[model samples]
Target: MRRLIKLGLGSLLLLALIWVPTSSTEATAQSQVSEIPNVYRGCWFQPEILKYRVRMTATTFTFGGGYYEQKHWQPIKQQTYRLSDQVTAGTFTWSRSTNTQGYHTIKVRGGAYHVKVSQGTLFVKQIRQGHDINGYELTFNQISHAAQVLSGDVH
Candidate 1:
């Protein structure tokens, strides 16, 4: 009779362990959207005022012109830009132009470019140009969600 009682207790403990994770996971998934609000709600890039800068480079290229964003051409002003780890250091070139009338084109090198931003997620495109090889694009995302998992904010 003692052996049977022990077996029943073990079974209950096992069930509890299994059920805890499944229920917590559901709760975590439901709360993820509420954590970040309207992160992807607008036109991410404003080409008219292309504010940007580069660091740890020999030379700097400024975009003193107008560009296109969402079918409109607007003036671009130079500003300081920050780069994440995803941006590789090397020869990089970027151009901005509108796909409509009154378009503007601006190009720059020796700096990083902002590729995409969505759902509180940001991506920086890195470029490396060489002989017989032009360049390549690399995308990066935030891993802070992993920290939330450790803190019990996510399961």
Candidate 2:
């Protein structure tokens, strides 16, 4: 009887150990829209891709290309303007049930883009036809806002 009781307690402990990680991971993976209300609504420019700039609003995403000079980014015309909808309410998670990175998906123009926010930085990846293509990732930092202000691209 004592051995059976010990085995039961061990099984209970194992179950608890298994349960704790899953719950916390799910919570982390399921990011709320409120957590990133205005983080994405601005213009983004990358130095590596100096000829291009991206702008985001509450309901639209725009991509344009031009040149950067004297701490300013100039876009001659909006190349691709797409109506975008934010996937709120934790609608999607990529890879593995235990994954803990939270991101937002902007569906537009026959594909989607994933925007991940970490420490006030935006990491964006473009997915075309359900596959993540190479050389289609962007990283935005504090300098992006400075450039936006300088270029008058604030929204």
Candidate 3:
């Protein structure tokens, strides 16, 4: 199943992120879980069309975790949401001056095709089961054991 593969790759990626570089086994045993990470990490997928047998990859780190989400989709009859709709979120450490923590910019796509992106605490995506649905159901998908690009002093 495609979901299985996606979940596996996401797990590997997280493990590699937590993996510490060491000169020996002893050094490997002394790594901390909250070390400063040095890269941008994200997850993506088009679950709606996975049955079509399309191979799409957003990010790949490794393979292996347990993450499950319950999803729901409802259709709106007369839509009025726009692409310009956006919401600023704060999911990670922040710089009081730059204000770029969490997601700096979230773009919405899909209200016309059953997928509408709105803003709240995080990037919100709604899915529907009809054409030109006015409203939609939504579920949040998150990759577990991930790190963020920290700006403030880590200590």
Candidate 4:
């Protein structure tokens, strides 16, 4: 009878374990929602020229799009990649460039780039060998549908 009771308790314990979700699952779900502020969530692009674009969501950051080359703006395919880590609240410093500093930041492409939003603009810069690359910095303004239509950006 003692052995039978132990087996029953073991089976009950196994069932309980199967029914309960582990903390890791909860953490992953929570982490999927980005830490970037809501004000920074949107698609941003250069004003006069569509040289580059960046889109931010509750869980993802996408960078790429129309690029300037050969002395003209060219439309390029955008690629989506995951942020290397959760965005944390704090300033990210890199060589004192104005666009390289912000109140919050996230890593991208295996820490190849640092992204930040400040004063309604999104800034992205590529990092190599622990330093920011010059001329590789990108600044984008939030896209406004109404403003774009009024500005003749949208037809």
Which is the leading candidate under TM-score?
A: 4
Alpha carbon lDDT at 120, candidate 2: 69
In terms of TM-score, which candidate is stronger, 3 or 4?
4
**Candidate 4 structure lDDT:** 0.58
**TM of each candidate vs. truth:** 0.24, 0.50, 0.17, 0.58
Clashing pairs in 4: none
* lDDT by residue for model 2 (1-155), tens: 99999999999999999999999887765443222246676766554534456666654566656765555555677554434123333222222121244756665546666777678677777788888775666776545356555554664
Q: For residues 1-155, what per-residue lDDT tens digits would candidate 4 score against the true structure?
A: 99999999999999889767676677786565545557667877865554566766655566666754433434577655543333343222121232324524454434456666667777777666667775566777865563444345567
Error of 4 at 43 (Å): 0.9
Any residue pairs clashing in model 3, and if so which? 12-62, 12-63, 13-61, 13-62, 74-137, 76-134, 76-135
Error of 1 at 14 (Å): 0.4
Please list the Cα RMSD from the true structure of every candidate, rounded to 1 decimal place.
19.6, 12.3, 22.3, 7.5
Number of clashes in model 2? 0
Error of 4 at 143 (Å): 3.0
Instruction: Write the residue-wise lDDT of candidate 3 on 78-108 in tens digits.
Output: 2222112121231112111211323222122
lDDT, each prediction: 0.36, 0.59, 0.27, 0.58
Order of the predicted models by lDDT, top scorer first = 2, 4, 1, 3
Q: By summed lDDT, which 10 consecutive residues of candidate 1 come out lowest? A: 51-60
lDDT preference between candidates 2 and 4, better one: 2
